[model samples]
Target: MTKDQKDNLFLLVKSLTKSEKRQFKLYVGRLGVNQDSKFLSVFNVLDKMKVYSESLILKSTDVKKQQLANVKAHLYKQILISLKLNPSHQNIRSQIREQLDFASILYHKGLYKQSLKILDKAKELAIVNEEKNLAFEIVELEKIIEAQYITRSISNRADYLTVQAKELSELNVITSKLSNLSLQLYSIILKTGYVKNEEESKAVTKYFNDRLPKLELSKLGFREKLWLYKAHLWYSFLMQDFLNCYKYALKWVDLFYDNPKMINLNPVFFLKGNNYLLEALYFIKNKPKFINKLDEFYTVVNQSDFPKGENIEALVFLYGNFHKINQYFIDGSFEEGLLLIPQIETELIQFNNKIDAHHKMIFYYKFASLHFGAGNNQECINYLDKIISNKSLSMREDLLCFSRVLNLVAHYEAGLDYHLETLLRSTYKFLIKMNDLHEVQKEMIKFIRGLQDIYPQDIKKEFRKLLEVLKQYEDHPFERRAFLYLDIISWLESKIENKPVGQIVKNKYLEFYA
Candidate 1:
């Protein structure tokens, strides 16, 4: 097996719950030969291991080096089959696919009547569940079966099936177009954090406008509406239009709420929609709305009918805690947020494989920001190092760029100025290479580099001057995104006032916004 496939097998094994592991063993042991099966033996060795090791497998099992790859491949397929049999994994979509498979088998046996009957029932279920793609397939299968026989209802049946096919094909086309637009927008954000200038903004706006389907909103189904809101959300995010982000994100979450069953069918979207809504609220500084919406999110998640399983469990923990920490940043109550770090860190380690590298790095950045706001400069630096030293470059460039910028700030605040110049030089060079050298970054770097020459009494004077320059761009078109990564304006005000940074932020919220 290739290295990625090998790691996938190991990760899959690690992801299984205790019951799932036991179920797999029972599934394999159903046959007497499986008790002493080579794959089972390999699985046993892997299950006992904390990490994958081919040498350890050879040392522990009777399986030879030459047969290891095949054995691992067999074990991987068998485990998935076992998982497929689990009741928790058998969702409505799987049920539809299963029925389609059965219908196909019956059709091959020339059981035309039986196949049509099954297809009819499956088609009804698919239509009722808004599974347009599957419904179209079921209709096509019905058409084929009908063509094989002469029936009393043949004339009526043929017309009905033809119309069904055309209608479903159209609905699927709309969904496909919307989903495609949403995905392309998401891909652009991952590659380039946001539009940096009018040219990029026009490109994104044109792309969105050109691809967006022009259907009456009232005529669209739940799925179509959901994707429409998501596309707009991403567009607003890229445009740095927080209020519009909030608007679409609210509509996204409301779509799920309005279609209560979709919440169960598509929990990932539900979780993400709420997260984005909260993120937008944070950007727009709407504390009251953010608090209310977050409460609503938890209420929905904590319900008895909410889906359960390892994957859902991991997602719930990740999104729930991410916004939980972000709330502190929103309010500048960093120390209170720090109280949850120990438990969150423990869970993060437990969920290390379940969560991806991007999310883990994001978590570290939030932790570092919390510590920085709480006046624990050294603790903040420790967390920042975790992000700075990471090797992966696939994360958003803006995220990576801000990690270094925040690191420079943390080091300077910690009285580690001896290291700041080298760090500042590296950060500037890194941003230039990333094509992310905005005015805010340049000004911040310029001020930090010139700090060594300024007299002690003149430091606050320079802070005031720097604050004036940054404030101008606090609402500037392309420059404001810098504040999103780090609230430089707030930090500067805190320094000028000689107060705790959190105090500065808390005062801002309570005074004007709150």
Candidate 2:
């Protein structure tokens, strides 16, 4: 049997909605010979099975082992065709492509005039939709038709197409370069988290500046500016410049609002831009703007006119749950945050394939944090254990390191002494191996390691001592990234003041607001 993840046919079958499934069946039934076809049998068998099983499929369907691959391939293509025919899946891009297809057929059948007419209309629509790549292709097609037919005013038409093609080509090249730079930077951040020190920052800055295209911001169109903002946003994130990240992310999101058609056309980018903006606000502790923007995001995404599809639904779920959890953290309502875990877990299962391992681990880290703030130490440990045990995750080494540090703190808070020394030694070695043993983690491990020697009466003093030490690093450019993962200062204050972590955070938030 093919591995479940690699079995695209089975995955597609399982991903289909009830309505989509019905549409596929009806589509298949439209052809009289396909009503009870072998592929239909294969689809029904595969859909009913919880997992992709070759043996079960052979037994349940008429397809033999030798023919199974071809059958499955046919079914996959048919399903995609059916989905393309679905109204929800049709958009401006699809409409333009359909016109191009019609023009191509007309051109082949010696209908040059009709083909040119269709190509002209398609090019206008593509340009209006900012589909420059397609527009360029349409221009090329028009040039080909005009070359053969020798249409009237051929001199002006040749010059017009030439200029349009050259300009579009230049703009597309710039968009491609910016998008490539943005993706590379984003990939680097995902694989290694933010740049760790000044050297790394300089390297990233150099790379960003070298690849970023030179262009006047005022002359760029919506698509060009969107990619430009994304490039800068990723660069800012890698540099740990949350203020600039906020600035570019806001520009990215606002560009869509300024051109409202793009909000629906490129909803995923709109959603991600807002998510990053909220993240930057969270980092800067701009509670009021964070709340306001988050509200706006939800309001826009929930609208009846908003784009809805499996991909969009998955992003909506991921971003919505993420910010919902962040809201609790901002408000210091950890107990209320705990209520979201069940729903998040449920959706996580439903969208397991759609959500990547790195993001799932992030949710686990947040889950552990919420439990820790709510004073559920054991629950925090349980969630942290998920991150610690996952050996395959290569992204976000920082998250891995902090999960262990947070795990150690949770065990201490839960009053586990017998294994404290064991955890301390292992965590120390792990941090050393990762080369991430910074002062904040160093002081934390040191304080926890000395806990056994300190008298019960001295515990508060130790907490106060650690609190004072971490406070200085809270503002340190490099060391402050640690606090972004776990609010150890607030945690220590909770211990020293004999209060819940959530209460300490809430008071801090209130103080910031005041």
Candidate 3:
């Protein structure tokens, strides 16, 4: 059954590494009776399966069709218990929880002193590591134990516990609120991109201010400050404030470097912070700092102790290669960047399951831009067509909108514009439907639409005029977002000057004398 093949247990079995599979079997051997169990039979069959089929499973194992569901569920739980006991899966959080578990067992056994001692150690570890949520739980257990039997001196233990609980509870509430606000802002950005107009800007600003909890800067701990900075960073992104994005992103990355242990403990957040920092630098066009920060990111991620889980590896691949390609765009070295495509494409195929459609399309856009810059117009159109023909993609509409605009340019450059009128009408309608036909896009579409009537001899002059018109919007608040998608100005210059767009950009960025 398709549903059977897509079940969580099937996927879980597929995700296990060889050693993990071996460990699961050895764990079963620990309880010799379980080795002959129906769940174990189901697991062994599923492990050998290239694809899950209810019928095949029924035939392979002693588990009957009626009992398959129960067996599969039990097997799933057993595998998880085996994984939970794995030494490789152990981390500080797990260790703290392990202590808490032992404390609970001891407490249930009426060993009050042993339980209290364990709880105290776990509470300290949780607080030190900013695991205050768990620390609060430990305190609650301590309170329960204290109520049953007082363990300490005449000083009020209840008063100390009450104060600790109250403080941690307050801090957790703040962290939760900030993190929620940050996620909401990020979702808005992913949905509609940066603030499109004054209406959207006003709405986002009001929402941010309304929900952001007020706090004293110096009173916050490491976790609270980290989420606080993230809230501001996402807000800055939604507001299209590049300088503020850079400022908050820097503070975010710096927070981790200031507390080195948190880096490995929270590797995903650390990678995300560095990625945002690199993005801010790219948006600001600061090549020097971008290069330095990118190098530093690669150095840190490649370190021996960096986390090696599947999801983290996927992110590292995503952000690392994404920035590396952006570096070529920043340097205007499209031809050099082309060398990376084959290898990247190979890797993308390998990461197909882990990476999402949005990121894949993003790389396609980057590839399209590279070809466009190097004057490989037909090649550029090839990539753009892949994006355009995908009718089901629900990525940010701006990506789709810009893809259409760039497709128009690539088609014209490739001399395949016999159907230019039809293409123009469809693209114009698409943008208008998305309510995104802004000035930069409007001018480009208008100029391209007017191309049919322009005399061949006057085309160069027309290109110059369009360039002058677009230059005014280079610093225009919302209009500039258009240029971030595609450098129409450079393309126009390339046309007017009769040079490759890549060369036009290279001359401006590369330090040839040095």
Best by lDDT: 2
Against the true structure, candidate 2 has what lDDT?
A: 0.91
**TM-score rank, highest first?**
1, 2, 3
| 102-209: candidate 2 lDDT, tens digit per residue | 999999999998898899899999999899999999999988988888777456998899999999999999899999999999999887788777788889889999
The CA lDDT of each predicted structure is: 0.89, 0.91, 0.90
Score every model by TM-score. 0.97, 0.96, 0.94
Candidate 3 lDDT, 48-88, residue by residue in tens: 88777888888887888888888888889989999999887
Q: Which stretches of candidate 2 lie over 4 Å from their true place?
A: 2-6, 153-155
Candidate 3 has a TM-score of: 0.94
Clashing pairs in model 3? none
- TM-score, predicted candidate 1 vs. hidden true structure: 0.97
Sorted by lDDT (best first), the order is 2, 3, 1
Lowest-scoring 10 consecutive residues by lDDT in candidate 3? 505-514
